[model samples]
Target: MTVGFVGAGRIGEPMVERLLAAGHQVHVYARRADVLERLVAAGAKPVDEVRELATCDVVVSCLYSDAQVLEVLPAIVAELDGLLISHTTGRPGTLQRLGHAAIVEAPFSGTADAVRAGRLTVYLAGEPEQVATARWIISSYAGPVVATGGRGTAMRVKLINNLLLAAITQATLRGLAAGRAMGIDESVLLEALAVSSGGSTAARQMDARGGSENYLAAITPFLRKDLVACRDAAAEVGVDLSDLLAAAYDGPMNLGV
Candidate 1:
């Protein structure tokens, strides 16, 4: 299959590599010329414009935000008769506004390392047929592509997952702080939590980064992005997330406001 890809940035770059490695003919486009150089060098054809991607069998969008998708993808998607797999994590309202027939919201959860290792989790939501068609392309890089029902449903799931991660990550931090106040060694507490009932993915991730400070610093920017997106999404639905947001923002790691 000939695949077209956009926003080939940090996370997207590895995915493009995985696709090309899987023997798909890949067409690449990025606002940054340097971003495409490595991809082109790895055998992807460089597409000069987003609209040009409309001709490919399938196009994957790895854009960073709802604003970028709204600004860059709609016109190109409007021209597409094939499927558009959107990996951008954004609000469902964006999809409703565009109302395209071919888009499959496939917001993902994982780092670039996870993508390179084929361990990324991609959530798929769109027309059933469109989603069924997306599995092959997505499987080149992501392991479990969860089919989440309708077009906007995946975004909601992604946002909800982000919120849970934020809350849990900060809760881990708060727990460590409480341990320290009681004169317990952080490592000892973390090691115990690793095998204890109170342990979580966030705690494991923190351990992987060597400690809380390093892990928080590394993921702060992404946490900021997801939290803001979650806030906006909740506000749109008239749902109050103050308690959740407060728990999320209660620590140093929860950088999103």
Candidate 2:
């Protein structure tokens, strides 16, 4: 399928590469001209204007936030009768506001390398037909496409998943710090937890770090926003989210500007 992408940042760039590698014609738009060089060299057509992408079969956005998505909608609304799948992790509500377009929320799990290796897990939410098309496009590059629900539902699942991840990641970090302070081998404790009741997706991420930036970049404004969204979503449903909020703000300083 012909695919268009907006916001060719870290996540967006990798996604474009994978889509292009999968034999799909990709058109990309980014604010910075320099970022498009690799995509251009890799056979992607660089779209100078964002509205140009409206002509594609599907346009996936991995933008920084909900407001950014809103800002781009007017430019392409007339051109986007086709599906708009949002690869951005935390902006389901923003997608819902685009009533003129058939919006799909698809948040991916795992990194760019995993995506290149066809190992990323993508959760999709949208209209049934749009979702089917999205699955076809996503499967061309990802490991599995999980259809959680329609439109905002998929993003809600993503928000919930990230909430759990944030809490678990923070707990794991504090555990590691405590273990280190007490001189208990952090590696041993991690291994023990891996086989114990506390073992979880968060522990697995800790194990995956292997002393890399993967874990270090865990605490960021981006993550905090997602977790807070999860809290708000839960509150809307009458569920208390104090614990999650506490976990989110516990290491606020760790999330540097």
What is the alpha-carbon RMSD of candidate 2 to the true structure? 2.8
lDDT of 1: 0.86
- Model 2: lowest-lDDT 10 consecutive positions: 248-257
Across residues 1-257, which tens digit of lDDT does each residue of candidate 2 receive? 77888977876787888888889999998787778888899999988789999999888888877777788866876668788877876655677666765877888777767777788899988778888888888776677789998777887888877777766667777777788899977777777777789777666655666521366565356676777677667777788878766775575226321
Off by over 4 Å in 2: 185-198, 212-214, 251-257
TM-score of 1: 0.91
Every candidate's lDDT? 0.86, 0.76
Against the hidden reference, what TM-scores do the models get?
0.91, 0.87
Q: After superposition, how far is residue 89 of candidate 2 from its true place, in Å?
A: 2.5
Q: At residue 206, give the lDDT of candidate 2.
A: 59
